[model samples]
Target: MDSLIFALNAVMPIVVMVAIGYAIKRAGFMNDTVTRAVNKMVFRFFLPAMLFLNIYEISDLADIQFGYIIYGAVATILMFLISLPLVILYTKHQDRRGPLLQSTFRSNNALIGVPLAEALCGSAGVVAAALLSAIVIPLYNVLAVISLSLFSGNGGRPNVKKMLMDILKNPLIQSIALALAILGVRVLFVKMDISFRLSDMTILFKVLRYLSNLATPMALLALGAQFEFSAIKELRREIIFGTAARTVVWPLISLGIAYFFFRDTFTAAQFAVLISIFATPVAVSSVPMTQEMGGDVGLAGQLVVWSTLISSLSIFFSCFILRLVGIFG
Candidate 1:
């Protein structure tokens, strides 16, 4: 009951926000233009604020367990590699490979992983996952962008250096770097007091926290607003592969392998959390990014929607099963 409550406390707000976005779109309050703008603001501003604030408060990075990072990164990379062969086998049209790859491996980790970490593993979990994310995001982006270019038949090979530069210049990356610098400097030389509650600070931090919290909902709502059930049905092959690989096969593969390395420090619940995080379908932003890279927006959009809609079940079940096995600590 306690864990159940915690899960609901963490997850319900995002679900409600998604419903609100869906409702707003239905009522015509949101259109493509507004959605795009809001997405940019949330992605560029609010999300980074949230990430920096979280990382800034992390006092003990050493306790985060380096093995988790190694295991998690390796697990993610392995999953990406595994998905490629399956992509060639399942998807014949070479064009579909790019979008399918994105849908397969790039997870909505920011929106889903963070909250679950906070709820279940406490601050340590958030800190660990946040650290893992710093490594994951840039890697995911490079692979995703390259796959997007290839599968879209956009003849030019993605310039690795350019992609790295863009990833480094990304606002979120800048914020994470700043936060880490603060954390490192504080750990080394300064003895700062955590005497002030965030509330004790000016309303600025307060507003920042609230606004940062808004990222998940805003992202989810934007996703809901773009949902297209008909398109998902139309592109049944892509949808099936995307949904199956993300929600089932890849996650299981990740957990099975990750557990081998992280068995001692990471509980079954933690493994469950990792599985759930990776199990989430495509990132909602994949649509725009795919289109930007010349992939099929309609198919990408449909896959994102279908993945998000089905993820709730996959995540809940994976968590529940892991709990039953006493693996999730």
Candidate 2:
């Protein structure tokens, strides 16, 4: 009950905000053009700012949990490889393949993971999720770029060089890379006993803070505006498969394996980090990425809606069960 309440407390505000967006759209305040512009801005600017701030704010390099970072990064890659074959086997619909493949492994970690982790383990869990994001979020963007490009199915073939360029040019990936580099420099400064701090740059940090604050809510509102209940029936098969992979199958396999095999090895907060990565919903970024990269935008949006709706229960059950088994202790 406690875990369930905590999960709800953490998740319901996002849900309600989404609902409000839906209501505004239904009332004709927003149109497709407006939604598209907002999504593009969110994708190109706000999301990247959010990713950068989260990664840059980590206190110290030596304080980071490299074991958890390696585990999380490796797990993300393995899941992408594993999902490629599974999605290929599941459907040959060119449109379905790309979105479904991405929905399987690319999570809403940037928006959803941190708060959920904090709910589960307070500040410790938040720290773990942040460090986890330093690795996992960039991996997600790279995989998203690759997956959408390969299965794009516009004609004869995708341009490999262009796809590679897209991956490198992705704002989110650029943000993560920049943040990592700066953090490394900061660490070196610490080693040399040089005075360096983010606070030294006040205006830039404030701008990033404002942009970061805009990212999640704008994305959620845009998601709400763009979501179509009618699209559910249109992409029922893809939606079901993607949502199930995100909200059920992955969590059970990953968390269950950790529970039985490495139970004593992970700290409680590390376990929470794992759950945040595994149990979170399909990303809102996928919808925009699909649009930008020429994939099934409708199916991608449907996947986000269903995945987000169902993931609340998935996360609750994961925490409940893990707590019951003493993982949260």
Candidate 3:
């Protein structure tokens, strides 16, 4: 019962916000164009602002839990490596091969992960998730490019140039860079015998705080607006395989290893970060990337919708398991 409450408390807010977005869209208050624009704003601007402020508030990088970063990076690469061959083995439809592979490895860590971190562990959890962004975001993007580029055109070689360019232009990476620059400036200020931190009165603080507060709600709303179910009947196989792999099989294996084998090594917050990595839904970005790269856009969208729909149950069960074992206090 305690674990159920904790899991529900952590997950329901996100689900409710998404429901509100769906309701608003169904009522015609916001159309596809408007909802899409909001999604873009949340991804490119609001979410980055949220991440920057979260990381920038940290006093020193030394205090960050590096194990969480390492754990997330390792888990991501393994998922990518393991899932690719398995997806190829399972599917004869090459159009869906890339999207299926992409969905298997790429979870919605930014929109869903950060909020989950905040819910379970508060500010400390946010910082752990933020630190993880530095390692996993770039890894996910590079792998996304690789996955799509490989099957984009008769399975030609991956475009390393495009991958590099995409990494450079990633808004999350850009935000992290800006935050690191700010951290450096803070260090310089310390050496110069001056003290400054973002305060409530400062315009930058006020603006960024407002934007940060909006990131999750806007993201969940945009997710709701984009949700679709009509294609489910046709793409049943992709939906089942993708949702199962993304939300169930992979998480169970990885989390079991982390819990039983590495229990003594990673902290509870670190375990929570791992949960975000392994438990969240397939990333929404996979849908657009699949379309742009000439894959099966229908299958990709279905994967996103179905995975997002059931990921909450996965997350709740994962949290319950961890709490039952006393991994979280």
Alpha-carbon RMSD of each model: 4.0, 1.7, 3.4
Off by over 4 Å in 2: 154-159
Candidate No. with top lDDT: 2
* Cα lDDT tens digits for candidate 1, 207-227: 888878876667677766766
Model 3 regions more than 4 Å off: 63-65, 91-99, 111-127, 151-156, 198-201, 283-301
The CA lDDT of each predicted structure is 0.68, 0.85, 0.76
Q: List the residue pairs that clash in candidate 3.
A: none
> Candidate 3: worst 10 consecutive residues by lDDT?
2-11
Query: The CA-based lDDT of model 1 is what?
Result: 0.68
Off by over 4 Å in 1: 1-16, 88-97, 118-127, 149-153, 191-207, 260-262, 268-273, 285-295
TM-score of each: 0.78, 0.95, 0.81
User: How many Å off is the CA of 83 in candidate 1?
Assistant: 2.3
Model 2, position 328, has a per-residue lDDT of 78
Assess the local accuracy of residue 98 in candidate 1 as a C-alpha lDDT between 0 and 100.
80
Per-prediction backbone clash count = 5, 0, 0
Indicate whether candidate 1 or candidate 2 has the larger lDDT: 2
